[model samples]
Target: MDFDALRRHPDLEAPGLAAADAADRLILDESASALAEVAGPPGSVVVIDDAYGALALGAMDAGARGVRVHQDPVTGERALAENAERLGLAVDERPAALPLGAGLLAGARVVLMRLPRSLDRLDEVAGLIATHASTDVRVFAGGRLKHMSLAMNDVLGRWFERVDVTHARQKSRVLVASGPRQGPASDWPRSARDDELGIEVVAHGGVFAGTGVDIGTRFLLGVLGDAVPDAATAVDLACGSGVVAAWLARERPRLVVRASDRSAAAAASAPLTAVANGVGERVEVTRADGLEHLPDASERLVVLNPPFHSDAAVHTGIATHLFAEAARVLAPGGELWCVWNSHLRYRPLLERIVGPTRQVARNPKFTVTASARRAASPLS
Candidate 1:
C-alpha cells in the first residue's frame, strides 16, 4: 500500500500510530489487538524503540499509563520524539530516548522491542534485558519473518523465560518470553590480546570481530601507528568496540582520542573497552552519525573501517556520508584513513572529497586508503 493510502486508512489508525518511509510498507504497527496479544495493559510500563514505537503507542492507547520509547542515540532520537508528538503523547524527560541497555530496563514491567537487523548486536541487547528485567516482566519481541532465525530464538530463550512463537501477520512474527530472572551477564565472551601497537584489546559480542581482531583492523592499526602525526586530537570514526581508539590512546597517552558510532550500544561498549585497557582517561565516547557533532576542521586524524552494509542491504550511503563529513571536519592537512571491502569503490569518493587519495595497504578482502586534507582547497 502507498503511504498516502496507509495514512488515510481508518484501520491503520487503530494501531494508535503509523509510520512509513517514502515507500509506505507499514514500517510499524502498534494497534490495540497487537499490543493486547503481546503485552496486557493497565499499570504496565511499555518500552519501544525505532519501528516498535507503534506497539508502544498501541499499549498507551490500550490504557497503558506509562510508556518509555528508546531510540538509538545516534539515529533514532529525533524520529522517536517526533513519533511521540504525532501520537499526542508527552515525551519522557529522562535519558530514556537512547539505546535501551541493561541499565535502562531497571523498572520496566513489559518491553515490546522490534529486533534490529544487525544480528551481531542481538546478544548485547539480550544480555542487557536479562540483567535488568524482573522475573515477572514479559518481553515480547518481533521482527519480519524472514529475519527470524533459530539462533535468535535460542538467544532470547537463554536470557528470558519460555519462548513461544506467534503466527505471522503482515509478514512479521512475535516471540513471547517469560520466566525466572536469570541475570548472569556473560553474554559476550571476552578475548584479550596485546596488539603490535602497544594496546590491550578486549572484545565482546556484537563488536566487529568479537571472536578475534579482524585482520583489516589489525592492518589499519599497524599503518596508524606508523603514519599518525603528532597531533593533539584524533577520532576513530566507526569505532567497533574501541579497538583502534584505545590503541591510539595507549600509544600516544597525551593525545585525546574520540570514538563514535551510529549504534548507541557500540558507543556504550566502547568506553568499557577503553577502561578495561586503562586508557579511559584519554578516550571520549560519543554516539553520533559520522562527524555530525564534531566541529569543522577539529581533528588531525580520522581512522575508520567504513561499513558497507547497513543491516542486510549492501549500501555505500554511510561510507559516502562519512567521507564527506570527515573531509569537512579534518584540519588542513588532516588525514582520513579508512579500510573497506576490496570490491567497494571508495577511492574516487575519497579523492572527490579529501583530494589526492592514496592506497596505503590492501589484502585479499579489504583495502586501506588514506587522503590528506588539501591545504589550499575550497573545503579548507
Candidate 2:
C-alpha cells in the first residue's frame, strides 16, 4: 500500500491521535527484511495492535495475501477499514476486522505487532500468539526505543523459546521471535476486591493500573453525587475499566449509569467489572466516541476524567473535546463533574464549554471541578 493511500478515519474523534507513525514504517520494513532473510512459508500474515492500517496494509503491499489483523482500540479498527476502502483494492474488510482468536491466526506464518505501552498487555498479546499460532509462525514486534523496555524482552521470553533483538534504526527496534512454547494458563482479566468500595474489580489486560484504582478516578469517586444532585441517570464518560461506573451503581442502587469508551478492550472490561461487583445488569456499558450514541440533553450527569493525550502526544484538545460532548449531552441544570491534572487548569475552558465551573476539590496533582449547564439553553 502506498503511504499516500492510507488515511486516519476522517470521523475519528481524537484530536492528536496519529494515522501512522515512524515506528509503523520501521516495523513493516524490518518484518519484510526478516522474511526475506529467512525465506519462510508465508500465509495468514497477521498484524496485532496496529494503531491504524499501516502494518496490515503495508503487509498487503508487500505481496502478503489474506492479511488478518486486530486493533484493540475501536477507533483504530474503524480507521483501518476506512483506509482499506479508501485504497479501492477490491476491499473485503473481513480480514481487517478479525478479533484476537483462532480465526485471526488459524495458520499464521508471520505476524507484525506494534508494541503496547503496558507490559501486562504485551504479555497477553504474546501469550495469545504462542498459544494459537502455527508452529512455524514468526512474530516481529517493534516499538520506539524510548518507550520500549527490558521487561518487554522478559515478557516475550516467557512465551517464545528465543527472543532476538534487532539493531536500533531511527531510535526504533524490532524483536524477532520464533518457537512458540506452551506455558501455564494466561491470567487475563485478573480480579481483586477493592475493600474501600466494597466490591470486586475484574480488569482485563488493557485496563489501567491493572486491578488497582487510578488516583484521578479514585478522587472523582469520592464525590460523585455532589456534582449532579438529584439526577437519576449518570454517565461515566471515557470510562476506563469502569471503576466509577461500578462504584456509582453500588452506591446508588436507584441510579441508572452508563460506562462508555473508545477502546474495545476497555468497553469489554467495564461489563466484566460490573459483573464482578454484582452490578452487571444495573450498569450499561457501550463502546463509543464521547456521547455520539446518546441523544441531546439526555444525560443528567456526566462524570469524566478526560484523557489529556491523544495516542502518545500530550494534547489538551482531547479534554476540550470531551467537555464539548458533555455540554451537548447534559440536560438543562445538569452538571459535569471532572477530574484532571492540576497543571492543565481546565477551569476557564470548562466555564466556556459547559458553563459556570467551580473547583469542587483539589490536591497536589489533580483538581476536581463541576460545571452546571445553563437551564435556559443546554447547547449554550
Name the top lDDT candidate: 2
The residue pairs that clash in candidate 1, if any, are 15-31, 30-54, 161-178
lDDT of the candidates, in the order given: 0.67, 0.82
Score every model by TM-score: 0.81, 0.93
Q: Model 1 residue 82 lDDT?
A: 51
Worst 10 residues of 1 by lDDT: 4-13
Q: Which residue pairs clash within candidate 2? A: 1-61
lDDT of each residue in 50-133, candidate 2, tens digit only: 877888888877777667788877778888888877777576533457767677877787889988888888888888888888
Residue 9, model 1, lDDT: 21
How many residue pairs clash in model 1? 3
Candidate 1 local Cα displacement, residue 109, angstroms: 3.1
Q: Which has the greatest TM-score?
A: 2
